[model samples]
Target: MKQTATLKFIRKHSALAPICLIILLFIRPTYLYAEELKLPDIGDSAATALTLTEEKMMGAAVIRNIRHAGKLVDDPLLIEYINNLGNKLVSVSNNKDYRFNFFIIDDMSINAFALPGGYIGIHYGLITASRNESELASVLAHEIAHVTQRHHARAYDLGKSYQVPVLAALIAAIVLGSNGNELGQAALASIAAGSAQMRLDFTRANEKEADRLGIKILNKAGFDAHSMASFFEQMYKESRLYGSQGPEFLRTHPVSQNRMAEAKLRANQMQLKQPPSSEAYYLIKQRIEILNQPDDKALLNHYVLQLKNKTYTVREATLYGYAIALLRNKQLNQARKVIQQLRKQAPSRIAYLITEAQIAAQSQQYAKALYLYKSALDDYPGNTPLTLNYIEALLKQQKYGRAKSILVTHLRQPSPAPKLYKLLALIESKLGNQVATYEALAHYYYHIGQTHQALNQVNLALKTPSLDFYTESRLSARKKELQDELTALAKKPS
Candidate 1:
């Protein structure tokens, strides 16, 4: 029955098949005999099994698939917040050489997972569920440890004696299992029923090591070291409350009394300190709450009730969320009033300033909005959210040239948001620069994992009339890169 459910789940999510195939293609058993295989050693032997480049490729491919499935949260504010928080922990981590990319999964499940190559994904639900920043940081630190320890590669190394298909299935199962779906649970169970006990034992060991290291990283990063243990204890208690259906995090990172005790004991040995959570964390949480609401009026009403009853923990964040809800509901005057109140409290708070600017823009006061953005930019120059908003206000006023210039400057920075490319495409289109528009659109599509659309845009650019020699050369080269990527993807076993 479990096997049937597992197969059904795999068939339903057909996009995952290519991910498995990618893993199989990259990870092959060179030594057929188990006796001849040398097990992974303590010191970076996993690197020998799966090179960093291969791990990166695998991680990127999985991320692309996840993006294609629309499971990646695209909110720039939330993205920036999570990355900033993740980097804070990364900065103090022992693995200084590894480049970490942190992202949020749009999932509501309370889980986090680490893909190969330092790609860590936290569920928005986990963020919402966390009582404080340290709880969230602890989760991120644990995932970071998994990546730094090269657990995925080490698992591949350990599984060399097993069939490649089994190993691939196991990898897929683990990813899906973190989602807390019945089919995913079935898949995991089916895989475990096989001769995967040794791998399971290794996973438990990895979990322990990750806990120890995560606590150290958390403490070093100035977070409460006990957060790891506290979070686990909370999850364990919640598991009892939910009976057989605990949090997805527990399904993946099973918390036991013994494990919790060990974490507590380790944390007790550290110099504990209570650090205040950042205001940005609360503001971002409220923003996400507003974004997740399906109905603006309903959300506005909910916030009104919360405020009326004084049920909110953070009044400023509640007000922030209420203001956004009001804006979304097109209560422009009320939204402006609320945001003005917030601005009066903290004249330079970016979230309040942005909200006020948005209110002005929505009221069709584009000049006021532009002035507000410009004033904020003067204070916080090169701020991504501010720059993005300012460029957007410029575009709204049909000041395409100014918007283009600002956007171009922003794009020159490393890893600009994908939305920026899409915005640039709009700016170029407004200016009637067909080649530039197409090129920008191609970049936008590529970043969002729409390779075919990206390739189409590139082709369109190359076919544009009177294209300059230089532009044509660049477009042609990009076109080949896209084609090669597509060809390689197509070549993966079905």
Candidate 2:
């Protein structure tokens, strides 16, 4: 009886249950409340449903909303590490030219979802929940498989056939609406009158397909494919242990014994590659453990106990986490000492260099921070975190010219960061280059999915009196691009 009650509680209070798998519904013929946000084209229900270009448009819209919510982890190193793993899978997958974009949401819910145009988000809870990098990679591979299979597009077609506009509205309500009872009531109301079971069946089919392809991709990508089945089995056991209140993942993605057995059998057929433990994977997981919890000192004590008990899966990652906790607690000397020990243990590690540079910056040792940043950049040229930090340190020292030069050079690369434009705008503002500042802001807005705003800003830039031909040419071209985007977005059925 007690166990049943616990299971009920888990079902009632699942962290991400309200928003689970709703991303897949995007770009399908469901009228969402995206009108409230005034976002760019949220894709209409065409006979063909989802086109590649329209899917990319929807991805931009979803990314902006998630980003503005500040739910994504802001750390660059963790993002880069996840991207490296994602790229590995993408490189080996059937869709070789896919522009896979992976992101981490700060939520502690153990769930992941794929969006249109190769966008995927994994909750921080999912990352920390994994027993190994392969387990994590398994989840990622599953999500990637969903994207590559165009499962969302087919799901959209199913929704169109159901003619359930309310389903889409309910998802939008959960995502863009108020919190607490309002959210729960909206979800309950939707479920009470909707074909919730049918939706689940649709999603289950996608899950089964993703698992089949994911295990294959996992093997090809050199990950321990068995880890996929193992992780599923572990989640099932964990759900039972937690009174059937499985992770948010299992709440939305139901798992069965038969499914687990099939995954095991398929994985067994493939000879395992047995990749070594990823240093960045473990270290990033530990650091994210500290990052997710609000109280640094409390988390520090938790790691301390874990470290002292010597019960951790990865000792080096624990120590690295301990050092970061020390730094957060303002124990600068202790942090430095611990990081030095870490450096001795792993001298050529990029994470260690980043941590060391951060410590120097925090301790008001700007020169040391600059030197370390430059040194690390020399080794890993164009590294986002290193370059961003280096530019920041220079900006802090009022070296606008140096910072601007570096920013310009970084911007010249194809696929320059959206953030660099913001940084460039800051530098322009400092140097009092009004036209340049607006132009930079324009590009930043455009990249972040606000095409109309970008167009307005570029027009403002072009209005500047007596602009140079070079600057005018660039601004004019940018304005034209933004206009084209806005026109495309306008033509899409809202």
**Best-fitting candidate, scored by lDDT:** 1
Counted clashes in each candidate structure? 0, 0
Q: Root-mean-square deviation of each candidate, in angstroms?
A: 6.7, 8.2
Instruction: Mark the regions of model 2 whose C-alpha exceeds 4 Å error after superposition.
Output: 1-49, 155-209, 412-417, 446-456, 468-494
Give the per-residue lDDT digits (tens) of candidate 1, residues 458-485: 9998888898889889999999988877
Once model 2 is optimally superposed onto the true structure by TM-score, how far is the C-alpha of residue 414 displaced, in angstroms? 5.7
The Cα local distance difference test for each model comes to 0.73, 0.70
TM-score of 1: 0.83
Relative to the true structure, candidate 2 reaches a TM of 0.78
Give the Å shift of residue 319 in candidate 1: 0.8
True-structure lDDT of candidate 2: 0.70
